[model samples]
Target chain A: MMRAVILAAPSVDALDNPALSALLGLIVITLIMTLGVMFATWYERKAVARMQQRLGPMRVGPWGLLQPIADTLKLVSKEGVRPASADRIAWDLSLAAIFVPAFLVLVAIPFTADWFVSPMDLSLLYILAVGGLSFIGFLLAGWGSDNKYALLGGMRAAAQLISYEIPMILSMLAVVMVVGSADVYRIILYQDVVPLIVWQPLAFIIFLTATIAELERQPFDIPTGESEVAGGVFIEYSGIRWSLFQLTGYVNMYAYSLLGAFVFLGGWEWPFGTDIGWGYQLLLTMVKMALFIVFFLWVRTSFPRLRVDQLMSYAWKVLLPFALAQIFLNGLVLVYDLPDVVLLATSGGGALALCWLVYSVVRVKPRQPLRMVGNVPATAPGSVSG
Target chain B: MPFEALLENYLAVFLATIVGTILVATALIGTRILAPYSKDRAKVTSYECGMVPIGRTRAQIHVRYYLFAILFLIFDVEAIFLFPWAVNVAQASHSAFWAMVLFIGILAAGLGYAWRKGVLQWNR
Candidate 1:
């Protein structure tokens, strides 16, 4: 079935040609990303449940296998609500605006060496540009609701996303400079002898950190921190609209994982060998992506959210400089023809510098509690007590 | 496939975006039709934990976000220039490498200036 579609897709007429294949690919990927979310939700619940010593969703199907499906049905059947003061057009437009960009991200992602939608020359740039657009929907949703908290949430999310994007791009820039291509496949191919992770551990760490922030995962998820400003930009959405946001979040998580795997983890090629067939490479890439996803989940459930102010400072103060320095180091290596050992040493030195930089920037004097115990009137009715 | 066939691949992306949007719209509109919507005055108003809402959303947004937009534009354009240069690196001379170094040095200096000015502090 798949073979026929791939081979026959080009023979069709111009309008029908790409559209047919696109339609088929979209449906397949949509289903895959949807299923990825479902499995991830179950995996998260089961993992966290076990870690916390509790059974999670045991009654729904065998071992809670059907829970995501059940949740989807419930969401589909639930009434969709709109805020009274909401801007109707933006409220509706926000759903597509957020999700379409996320879906477009899949366009540039390499599922396998052979299987991918668009292997464009600027695929890397394409992904980043489209990924950046997702937050705008949140901004619109926040504003459209005419809710104060929503606006705050939206702005906070905007600031976090925009700040983090610099480090993320800069980290990718390091790899792009070393490999000498912005093409995803070309980058992956450059890792045949040794993965980029082994080549540039510091960039790997920076990229992962920035990616977590980009996805708004825990330790960086203050935008939707329930303890503070309610659900933030997504507060007003309900029913299917809310589900789209949820779906976008999960899809983005998987997409970034795939990107990390491709760029740093040797992509489809295994670390041990480069002669592996497409099948093995595909499996290897998926395994790497899965490992990344699991790591993200662990970090997410384990960490507490950072203050919004701290998040901004971390991006600008720590990550941005580290990224810039890494770029300089990588450029120097390229110009001077440095050996792998030197690059490795540079990675080590870069890591130490990053740690020191963060420590210095985040250090602060401990706060003392208010000296005055319970509220006593400054001037007691008739006489003032000093 | 020919190299020219490469450009056609993006058509798939454009189509996929439309399909994905339709899929979301299907779920949203599906629920909108299948599920009952209650549009009572109180139900439709913004959520505030059973209390009345105060103030407007417009006045609350600070100018820092606008700064973020400008900063993002600068960096995005920088990345855009880096892409083509990175792609053509193999064909370029040692001079090409120095030229890029100059470009990125200026970019970093600009970011450093912004940091020194405390333009990146979000909450302040």
Candidate 2:
């Protein structure tokens, strides 16, 4: 009985009591997300500023470490002006609807082998499902604002989000098929010998594109494109509400980066194996996550915003078919009991094909202007009226 | 039990939601306390790049968005069916693979038809 108790204790999680674990996990994760988002804001500004050849926020604590805090303080103290005609309930609910899920996804993320708010069997699915709900908040914000720009931005945001979600889920489906598990922990463990990126480069590429689109970052940021919509859905928000939305965006960046790290980059498993202590596990996870974040920031500073039409077309036409093809290939291999090298060959070929497709599309006649240029008669054939 | 473990895991998520709500509520209240507020009619009116607003805020959207939404609904459901098949594909037989191939083939066929119809074309 004593030996049995010892073995059982090992099976139980560190914080075995559910209620206490929930409370403690919530507090720790909340604090981390808040501080991490603040740091991310500072990091992004500094990174983007450097890329543009300018010093960013040098006045605050050494190297402008305190800039995000100062910005937060200013935003918090500024008046939150709600438009008189805005829908009360929708506008109010949008804030929490967007903000909470950004924080809630942390509950299932395994920071290390043993360190997690909860070790879930279906963590990947849970995160995807929870993350998808935030688009509803965007719709509500857009409809409730009683502003045309907000409504336009909201519709684009909703449409863009739903479109990109398909490719993201499909890419994840490819990974799940290869690993035979939807549990993120097991998926990471499967990569102990070899990371999935080698076997499913196509899926990795698809996931990367979908991640950028879903985040609504540069190139895919039509919903909030400053030049076009002038702050889009966020146009009518001010003060704390505005800051919260911005904060949620950063938090989501962190969340998706972490997800990418765990799924594609092998999380805390590869290179060092599972025997490493918690400190190394934590280090590995953070470093991989930082790689993703930097790539995101780099992409943000580099790419021009894609046209809405191009964005939607690419997701549905190009990415979706490729993603589905990846699943089919994986199924074919798995059922045939083929060696792993076959996966690399097939997926690598698909990646090349995808690249060629993009290159060929670009090489073709430049995309027609949405309408004929200035001085075209409104009634002229093939001319569009705004 | 498996069910018990599942409940324990999700209980944390539930608590996280509640805690998140409290945290956001506190921030809202804190902002209310810290921020200065004096309402003005012009300030409350909808923003129109400094112009007095013109017409209805809720205008009719294009029909294409609704059409794309219907397309999305169909594809999303297809994706849902694919997930379980994906998880068990390794142990499953060749017949299962062929079944999925047929299912996805039909999806691709529909997508191709949409493309041919110019439903995927945004400008149209």
Candidate 3:
């Protein structure tokens, strides 16, 4: 019975024709990802709201489960007002520029043991390369909007995204170095005895930090900070167009979460040792991915947005050096045929050093309390104080 | 056959791109059909928190952004070069490892120079 399901799974050659299989696999994964992102928005709101001791989205459905659907309906019916000053073509085309790459990254992601839309030799590299293309969309939105806020936001988004991309790629490169394969499945298979995170804890930590920054969640969400450039590159987009930007954001979040799960958490091959069918493999993938998403939401709720200067410095000065160091360490071990235990020691020490560096920088002197000046008179007479 | 397999892999991505284009087009058309449109001058005016817009939108941005872009290009290209080397490191000879270290060291020196020049400083 299990053999039948495994045989029927959507691997590279599930159907008679490869084209047909590709089409069918894309549709299934697309639908699942869309629903997953929808559920994610509702979950993020509820989770973050609960963290702040507030009940969120109580109305749309049971526990506001249908809120994302309602949001889609509302956004779909809202007017897409283009600014008269905007570049009409680029403004409209930027949506496709951003949204398509988010979906393209899903092409190589394996949800189960044999259920990927495409299995490439360098699927890991493909995902990263495709994922980087969305920065162009942000830049286009900023340039085309003809709004000051949007322009400011767009440049910020591009800078932040590109700055974070280096460390993220390098961290993944460290993993690839260890496994000696950039293929996602092979990387997972190598983790049969122990997950890569145990061997490369520094890379794991750097990847997590960089992923948060890449996803533009709080602390790193300087581009879209409500207190600053309004909605940033999305300041001019309204209605379905605006909602598409938001949808891309959530989709990217899910993509990164899934990537992190497969890369560091041993994907479905850990503990269970890859003998289980696709059903359990899929379950393991979802559980690990959910852990990543929840951590993102928790960080989003708990952290304050970093200053723009601090954000850039953190990427260049802090994360980049550590990431390069991770690569060097991995190379050292692999070159000399060193024992795996050496990796745990060197990387674990590197992780500790990274933590210390961040902690030392973050531990600044507290600001003095505000000293209010006494005015001639209070605006409200009874509310006046000395 | 191997080449065909490679094309099949990319075929999935191509199909996804087509689907995405169709999805965006459908959303645009669906909004045109379902959403309301009113011709108000105020609505079309470039949004600036309900105030009369003062200057052109594409004014001079900070020069720092340009510097960062150039830096990003250098590092990004370096990273691309590292990927294939990284995957092949285990099978390669010890000399291969030293070669990478030299390559990275030179780049790191460049980075150090940039750092000293205050290129990484945002506010300064």
Which tens-of-lDDT digit does each residue in A141-233 have in candidate 2?
Answer: 999999999999999999999999999999999999999999999999999988999999999999999999889999799999989988899
* Candidate 1, A1-386: lDDT as tens digits: 65566566656542345566566667788878889898988888888787678988898999999999998888888887788778998888888888899989998887777777665877887788888887788888877877877888888888888888888988888888788888888888788778898878888989999999989888788888888889898888888889888888989998999999999998886575556777887789889999888888788777778887778778877787788788777766767777878877897689778877767655554654545436853432323111
Sorted on TM-score, best first, the list reads: 3, 2, 1
The numbered model that scores best in TM-score is: 3
Candidate 1, residues B1-124, lDDT tens digits: the string is: 7655764757777687778778877887788788876668778878877767767656646788888789878987887787777666646677888888898889888988998888877666
lDDT (C-alpha) at residue B19 in model 3: 90
Q: Judged by TM-score relative to the true structure, which candidate is superior, 1 or 2?
A: 2
Q: DockQ of every model listed?
A: 0.63, 0.79, 0.82
Which pairs of residues collide in candidate 2? none
Per-model TM-score on C-alpha atoms: 0.89, 0.92, 0.93
In TM-score terms, candidate 2 sits at 0.92
Docking class of 1: medium
Cα shift from native, residue B46, model 3 (Å): 1.3
Stretches of candidate 3 off by over 4 Å are: A1-14, A364-386
- TM-score, predicted candidate 3 vs. hidden true structure: 0.93
> lDDT of all the models against the reference?
0.80, 0.89, 0.89
DockQ (C-alpha) of model 2? 0.79
lDDT score for residue B64 of model 3: 93
